[model samples]
Structures are given as C-alpha cells and as structure tokens.
Target: MTASPAFERLAIVGIGLIGSSLARAVRAEGLARTIVCADANADHAARAKAIGIVDEATTDPAEAAAGADLVMLCVPIGAYADVARTIGPALKPGAIVTDVGSVKQAVIDAVAPHLPEGVHLVPGHPVAGTEKSGPDAGFAALFPGRWCILTPVPGADEGATRKVADLWRACGMTVERMDPGHHDRVLAITSHLPHLIAYTIVGTATDLEEHLRQEVIKYSASGFRDFTRIAGSDPTMWRDVFLNNREAVLDCLQRFTEDLTALQRSIRRGEGDALFDLFTRTREIRKGVLDARQA
Candidate 1:
C-alpha cells in the first residue's frame, strides 16, 4: 500500500480513547512525523506520554496545537468551543482542524467562530467506538472497517477535507461525506437511542430490590450484558452527545416510547397474535441490521 504525505506534526486535543487511538494509528502508519496530545486531565496527558502514544503531551491545548499541520479535537462535544478558543491563536496558517466528535452540527457551530480565516475546519465523526474511555482503552485496530463521515461547512477548503479523509482511510476506515443535519438524524436512531435505552435499563435495574438487583447482575446474559457494556461508556461523552443531539434524539425517543407502550399493552391483554406480529417485525429489523453488517 502507498503511504500518504506525512504531516509535519498531528496534534490531538484530548488524549482519551479516540485521541490515543489516532496517535497510535498515525505512528503505526507513518502518517505524521510527530504526534502531540493534550488533555484537560493532566494525568491522562502524562499517561499518554509515558506509554509512548504521543511524542509530546501537554495539559494546554494551545501548546499542543502550535505549529502542527493537523489538529484533531477528540473531547466531548460540550468542550469543543472552549478547546477551539484555546487553540485558535496557536494554530498555524493552513492547518487542518478536524474532530472525531459524535455530533457534527453542534461541534461545527461551536468551533467555527473561533477558527482563523486561513485555518480549515473539517468536522468529522468516525462512526465507530466502544464503551471504553481513557488513553489505555485505545488500539490501532479500533477504526478498521468502520465509517468516517466528514461534514464540511460551505466555503471550507476541499483540500483540507480530503486530507482529513485520507488520514482516516489510512487508518483503515471507509470515508464518506455527509450533511451535518442528516448525519445527526441517522445517528439519533443508530447510536443515540440505543445508548439512551441502555442507560435507562441499566439505571432501572439498579433501582430494583436489593436481592433482585444482585440476581439480575448474577444472571445477566446476552442481551442484558450487552446493555451493561453500553451503559459503561464514558459518562461525560455520552451526556454531551444526548444534549447536543437533543432534538433528534427526543423525536426518535417519542416514537420508541409509543411502540414500547403498544408492546406493553399487547402483553397485558394477553394478545399473542399482536405480540407475535411485533416480534416478527422486530426480527426482520434485526435481520436487516445483520445484513448491513452493523449487528
């Protein structure tokens, strides 16, 4: 495989799972001559450096971004604006500013105003992740076979967007261009709603009678275990995602709740046919997910 042009330095703000993973991938593929990371949590920055994930690690975002060819924001959506403000003055002219934030429009709105005229803003989301957080949770293989969506604002440089896309492709992702609003709507169903449900069920289980709670944990198998895994994701990141995508998530939630009520009514009325029909339809949905390679 041919190697892409190496960035002089790739700065990653927020040395968490995604950030550290990007660091590893960049180093492993020789995509950058240097990888620098910054984290609000000083210990995380120190840890990333100690583990050799980044050539330089700092607690200040400006220090990390200064002189870098590309800078990727990997923090929670809520922190994007603050990070952008901190790094704006430090970014080099023509530097590409991108992000791996799950919610695209909010991030774009938050970061765009702070960027200098010559700096490029290419908002992106790697439609891939796990319930884990922190630098240690990252691995180079995390991005392989996943989709990376870039939502470039009007008048943004095409060359910058292509460079970011090329970086993700080098890390083993399939790159796609998408509208921010459309991306938000799609993720509301595919990602957000599922996380909300997982959190809800896990929270409900915790409120059960003490003995029942213990039993639930002891007996949790396939489905419940899966929910638990999702519930374990970084609270800060997931919370920001929900708040940033509130409208889309709430719209999806309204439909989901009505469908759930119907299922509840079917079970209460002992309507086997109604229950079976719903179950059959849901099974078909599951099959579609499997066919799409997303299940």
Candidate 2:
C-alpha cells in the first residue's frame, strides 16, 4: 500500500515567494493531503490558488489555519505576533506551527505565547531564496541542495520537530538543528550583514549625482551589479529582519567597521603586505565555500 502523506492539512500564511514556493514543494513531494494559503494581499492569495499550487486560498489567517495539522508562517518577522494571535484560536490541539523567518529568537518571542497549549512551535529558517518576491516567483526547486535550520525551544515536542525536519528533507533540504541565539548570530554575519552592506552600497549609488548615477549603472562592474541584485530584495522583509535581529547585526557591523578602518589604514600607509595577507585569508574562506558546494 502507498504510504500516507505526512500532514493531513498544511496551511501557509503569506503567499509570497517563500510561501508559494513551499506550497509548490509540498505538492510536488506529496507531503500533505491538502494545501491552503492565506495572504494579507488578496491578489497574492488569489494568484496562489489560480496557479493551482494550493487547494484553497484566503485573506484570513484563521480560516486557512483551521484544522491544519501543519501551519507554516511565511510572513515578515514583524507580522509574526499578529498572525499567531489571529490563528491561535483556529489551530487545533497538537498542530505544529513553524516559520521560515531568518531571525529565530525574535520569532519564538513573538509566536510562542500566542500559541495555544499542545500546539507545537518549531521555528525554522530555510536558508535559501533569491532577490525575488510575490507568488509568481516561487518554484519547487528552490530548496534542493540548500540548508534548513530548525531552532526548537527547550522542552519542545521532539515528534513535532522531527516531522518539520522530515518536511524539509522531503523538499530536498539538508536539515540541521541549532540553538536560536546561535542561529541568529551565524546568520547575522553570513546573511544579515551582507544584505546590510549591499543595501548601503546601493543606497549610496542612488544618492550620487544624476549624471554620475547614470554612468555608474551604464558601466556597472560585476560587483556593483551583484550588490544591486541583493539590494533589490523586498524592502519590507529586510527591514523586519534588520530590526528584529538588531543586536546581532549591530555587533557584526561594529566588527566589520573596525576591520574596514584597519583596511583603510593599511591602504593609506601603503602597506601592500597587510592588504595581501587579508586578501589571502578571505580568499581561503571563499575557497572553503566552493569546496563545500555552497558557492
């Protein structure tokens, strides 16, 4: 006999890129008996259903969440509490509520208290995405070969955590468990800081004189082009990310500023050796990334 699907009903809130992508992935993997989505944007909710990635779609979080065995919150970090509150009453006992936000500790802070007893919260980060948004931008292949981190609070139900991990595995991600604080610190450097830098650089370019700005775009090198792509990500999402994880991001930013000041001093003093040493070390990190097949 064919095995049963992992979840009887899967509900996804925020049918934007990640949310729609997850719905597609779940359908592709046959991991849920039914998939439904709710988006604050009515157009997005309708588009998700029109595209047939979900069995049903609504503008109401509670409506979508009712009777769902799994509820995935794909909204921005700032909206977590409100969404949780709206869906808490609708969530049945024993339901698993998880998220794809980059910040973990804040998610738990916002979502945990609102969840009814017996409803498990398994905070997660898929560690994948592009500078894209909206329901049309998602695809089932986005999770393949990427990492998905789960940050279950102490005393969380082990079975719920395993089921969420299994869902990501079925969607083709390699899963790892992490402490929420550690996950925030790690992502602060690898993802958060980089995006911050990109936004700063791109914002600087936009502030240039009109003629210079046009010229910058006309003759843009690969580096500036790459920064533009990163900066092109949804503003609401990144704003929530930076705000929610301010402490870690600010810590990383301070260290980066200090390092940058040192580099400036080296250049001003004509210290080629110091520059070379720094470049050599950073190059090894790049090589390591490539070696790990993550580049």
Best by TM-score: 2
lDDT of 1: 0.93
Candidate 1 vs. true structure, TM-score: 0.97
Q: What lDDT is obtained when candidate 2 is compared to the true structure?
A: 0.96
Question: Superposing every Cα of model 1 onto the true structure, what RMSD results?
Answer: 1.4
Model 1 Cα lDDT, one tens digit per residue, 75-151? 99999999999999999999999999989999999999999989999999998888889999999999998899999
CA deviation > 4 Å runs, candidate 2: none
Cα RMSD for candidates in order? 1.4, 0.9
lDDT of 2 by residue, 123-164 (tens): 999999999999999999999999999999999999999999
Model 1: weakest 10-residue lDDT segment is 1-10
Backbone clashes under 3 angstroms, per model: 0, 0
